[model samples]
Target: MSDVLRQWQALTASLPVKALGLAAWLLAMALVFGLLERRFPIRPQRFLRQRLAQDVGYYFLGGLVPPFLTVAATAALVWFASGLVPASFYAWVASLPFAVRVGAMVLLGDVAFYWAHRWSHENEWLWRMHAVHHSPTELDWLVNTRAHPLDLVFARAVSAVPIVVLGIRQGNDGLDAAVAVYLALTTLWAFFVHTNVRWHLGWLEQVVVTPAFHHWHHANLPGTLSRNYASLFPWIDRVFGTYHLPARQFPTTYGADRELPQTLGAQLASPFRKPPS
Candidate 1:
């Protein structure tokens, strides 16, 4: 039994370290924010109850579903692709001086992710799938995982394809490492930006995406819907002329004006349901 346990540990050790690090970061943030909400206490008690309920639901769904599905799907796809691709391809990329591969993955990954994100918004059918994420009535840490499985799979597959294609072209472990680190950091940032904590880094929002910056994206107000699309960097939105900065106050409401179905099964099926006319 001890030997079997040791073998299992060795097999699991190959899992990305970033995923573990991100889990730790999210737990710490949740604790800090939970305490802050208790201390500061946002007004309108009814609103607080609603937001809290939604957050609880968010975490429940996150814990029960999406994470496991995503990990399993990604692991399987990578394993399958590994078998078909030449070992020499990965080896060649790995042999390149580290800086070149790192730079390539970062730029290419962001570009791929940018298009995938934009498409999720622009296509109504895809938006239906994406809307599960936007359906949260309150913006908070847990809202990050409310995405539909199809949207999640599509976005991840698109984001990864560029790196995989790069690996095929140049053959490198550095690309894999860079992608793993980026995925971990981006996942943590998604949670951080969704968090209710009031921490702000001021003008740093222009460079690194922050919680306050993304909270506005969840704003259901008329004009706010079209703004703040960039996932990691604000410059992409700015460069493309889609950026919109909210006034000093956060928006008072969230979710579409039309009532979305409340049940989890209903939400999963929502993408196929007719959109509000």
Candidate 2:
């Protein structure tokens, strides 16, 4: 227990600056989104009103919990694994060429996340855990954290498997660097993609994931609700043939057709129970 605490403190100490920077950036983006929503309000074609305070509160609490849990769980796992496995394994894996490790981490991580995300949609049991995310009637930057704890935990656990396996099999610093960079970028991109800003990068949506493209995923429109599951790159969607970019403007509606819980307890307990019928 003491060793675990020490390791946790060390990890947090090493990462504090980066975490603080990310928090600052997210706060700034939230402010910008709030300002934009006020300036160029999009009339809701749906019933829900913007609950800015609730949304901000949800983001603050939800965002902090998952990352802390993820990091702690990951650190514990890695620490234990290091004890069981030969140090040479991690060393060798980390020694692999930088480009190869980076490529492997990005591709493997995204593919893992992609399948996990798609399965959440396909499986009724898993969908319960994921439904809290879709319950939000509003689409804004903070709304991205509106996920059940189980859903977040499962996703992170699954995603880390590939990284862990790679580290043990080939142990390389490049892979570590790649994973770090990917997490940082993806975290920022998630906030940006969920923002209410209307900036579109023209043809770039064809390649990279953008706020406009992601907002469409949250759209309550029947067509878009079933499309755009890719987290970072659109190539996975295109390859799987699930990509659907409507020629029409963004959907005004958000959230599922069914009603969802508004209370914190209900949202936390949602994954275990069936969604409202």
Candidate 3:
């Protein structure tokens, strides 16, 4: 039994082993949330078979997204900063305790994503890319995965580049583990936030992003088109002045006000085409 335990500990340190563990956790979240949505849909939503196929494709594809753009950006950053960054800084970060590294990842990741999410709304080219996400007429529990690959790539690049660079600037012993844990939290919470669950977790709204807050962000209503930009923490929006949470009422409608192609391929291709006048 002791020898078996030692072998398990050794396997845990392997990156692929850690990845498989993350996958199992995500699958468990999906199963739990899938049941909850059926029992407590906050609002009625449409879920056609075609949409199911599209989203299922996205759900799997999302797992493959981060590494592409994030890795590229990390490589570019390293090439550019090699001369300026101190080698010892990364060594120091590697030496820190695990909990501290994870805390920094959450704090820094939220800040990075908040700005990226907000910019996707204001920037024309990016909005064109991001508009595919808002194209969903209603929020499915899996709506988190319905994002365009480019949009996912870009949002990911924005979130990762800074954190990894900071690690490189300082050190990165625990950075990989921290990022993995943060991404897992971010992905799982996304399902809950987009679910049809009737949860209005009252005061909890002040602590973190909730379906109420995110629902409003996607709301097509007059006061809601461009508000509530923070992805993880509500306080960040509160500080930056984009916060727009209403305690009791939820948005009655959702989706982008613009025209979007109905088919997945067209929607994917739409970003490259000229916008409708």
For each of the candidates, the C-alpha root-mean-square deviation to the true structure, in angstroms, is 6.0, 4.3, 6.8
Instruction: Estimate the TM-score of every prediction.
Output: 0.72, 0.78, 0.82
* Superposition TM-score, candidate 1 onto the true structure: 0.72
Worst 10 residues of 2 by lDDT: 40-49
Badly placed stretches (over 4 Å) of model 1 are 1-29, 36-95, 168-178
lDDT of 2 by residue, 55-91 (tens): 5556655555566567667776677676776877777
RMSD of 3: 6.8
lDDT of 1: 0.68
| Candidate 2 runs further than 4 Å off | 1-26, 35-49, 71-92, 168-178
Specify the highest-TM-score model's number: 3
Better of 1 and 2 by lDDT: 2
Clashing pairs in 3: 42-196, 89-170, 90-170, 90-171, 94-173
The residue-by-residue lDDT of candidate 3 on 1-277, one tens digit each, is 3544554455445547556765686578667877787677776554453477777666655565445555555566656555666767767776777777677767777888888888898888888888877877777677877887778777777776556666632554555665667666787788778877778887889999998889888888886757887778899988888889876777778888688887877887887888868
Superior candidate under lDDT, 2 versus 3: 3
Winner by lDDT: 3
lDDT of 1 at 232: 81
